[model samples]
Target: MTVIPSLNVPLLGVAVTPLNRAELLAHIRDAVQEGRQMLVAGHNLHSVYLWYSLPEFRDFYDRAGAVVVDGMPLLALLRIGQRARLRTEHRIGSTDWLDGLADLEGIQRVTLLGGTPAASTAVLRHLRSLGGDVAWQGIPGDPWRAEDVDEVAEEIRAHDPQVLLIGMGMPLQERIADQLAARLDVPVIATVGGALDQLGGTQSLAPRRLGTMGLEWAWRLATDPRRLAGRYLLEPMKLAALLMWRA
Candidate 1:
């Protein structure tokens, strides 16, 4: 059994295990090969509140096979406070990982959910351009309806996609994945917030150098100040609170 170290982040309200990129990839590959259902979560403090406030969202995390760390701040906290033995070398955002996955052949069918129709279309086109044999589907609009859940699940089952990528953002998408997980036997269901926008060209990712330096948040804030100013600016205050609580 591989022992993964748990990070002590009080605000998260759960023991977060640190799995290096390779370990994470291997875990997903093994899960797919074995035909076992898995839920993948990428959550921050705000998203954590979204999960705790919503029962459905909370249940999603509870059922996930793995919830990898995505936020740079979260990684910093883990490294500094938890004394974790993991390297903070790479920031494996779900969108980047999915693109990399697309390059690999004979893996599994991928179903994309969430984002606007236009964004979803771009995602499909990009994946096809990458020579990915993915079976893609998109929600009609931005916010998905509960009624559409079953229909989406039915389509996914018919396609039998090994991986389901939910981009509905935060608690909503995570809740949807949890509900759908109970109804279907899909191998991997990933809740990736705004990744579709990044993949679809509506939004740009931070340059590789910025990402490597853990300043990707700054890049995002620079790109859309009006949209991300409050979220990114206020995140530090929340981090302070978490650190105090841990102390």
Candidate 2:
């Protein structure tokens, strides 16, 4: 199995792997070819909140094979840690690379879980257009609950995909990813929050320039203020207190 280089900082109390887009894709390809298991995940500020507040969520990151920096603010914090060695390029949002999975040379089958039925349909349509040689399947994970794992695992076992992308959103997706990873032989199970929704055009992605400037949160707030305002505004303060308590 590939032992991905990981670092855990006291500031965040979470583990992260510093892999840029190309390196991340290469790692996924290698894991599949080598028949190795990897639970690919990422952390943003909201996930950081969940990490401190939820034990099961924290456990998933502690054991994840790869946790890349998904939030630019988190990347900035990691860069200061000297030991993390995170660079500007290491900040990878799923929107930046989810489409690239279609181009991976060794990957032949991919499964997508989560999003509404319409969103999953759109993702399948998009990916199929990119990789004619690959097979894509989507299992709508709407209304997902902890109780649904067994049925979902059975569905996954039938598909036998080389990669599985779960996007039911934080904590829940991470929880399901952890359980499914343990029960299935799939090589890579990536917990990719709402990347599928954005990719499927059901959700808007911030412009690339804005994301590069570390103002993607601002764009998200502009788009869905009611839902994201508290997350963007108040959570950071809560996170600060959590970090201080931990420190």
Candidate 3:
């Protein structure tokens, strides 16, 4: 059995567990069967930066039931520490969870709460293609707001999905998942960030080779400089600074 440890990034208020694909799926099944509520978040390097720089992000992560390191850069850092010993072949992520969830038995319905209409449709379609033939549904949404909470929650309650995936992007997804998990009777809710965006053919992710080398940030920055330049270029400096201060 793989023991789960909370890899604390002190001052940032994030406690991540080095949970690979297998462990995450098993944990979710157990949590759901026991009726245990979970506010799970997948954290990457950019997530770490946001968690530290944005107080709200930090707060949500701190309150989460489980946080998993979802990017290779963070996984590389963890490999140097005693907090975890994850398999090197893959950086387990929310997408892996989708596969894991799909492989399991008894997930009747799944409600997706974020991403554009097209992305939601594509992702749902893909998830349904998985082995268990999971029914992937969604609550139609656009540029989201706190006021939409009631509507979203009502939709979730109506669907009563066994699983909920929120891909509303970083802080917003985390915030919305936290709010929804508080009131909804759903079995499990995971804040998957932009994992659903991969479904949108337009939102191409970095290639596997680059990702394995922990250079996915570079690929993203190169492709979308206007949007991700600062994120990929400057935010990692904060991580280095944090490490230096800790040392």
Reference-based lDDT, each prediction: 0.70, 0.85, 0.72
Q: Which ten residues in a row have the lowest lDDT in candidate 1?
A: 1-10
What is candidate 2's local distance difference test score? 0.85
| Better candidate by TM-score, 2 or 3 | 2
Instruction: Identify the leading candidate in terms of TM-score.
Output: 2
User: What is the C-alpha lDDT profile of model 3 across 49-166, one tens digit per residue?
Assistant: 7876788888877776677877876676666654555665437666656656776766667888877777777777777776585666766555787898987898788878888988
- Tens digit per residue, CA lDDT, model 2, 73-110: 77777777745656677899887777888879888888
Please report the candidate that would top lDDT against the real structure. Answer: 2
Between candidates 1 and 3, name the one with more favorable lDDT.
3
Error of 3 at 53 (Å): 2.2
Clash pairs detected, candidate 2? none
In model 1, pairs of residues that clash are none
- Model 3 clash pairs? none
Report the lDDT of model 1 for residue 136.
62
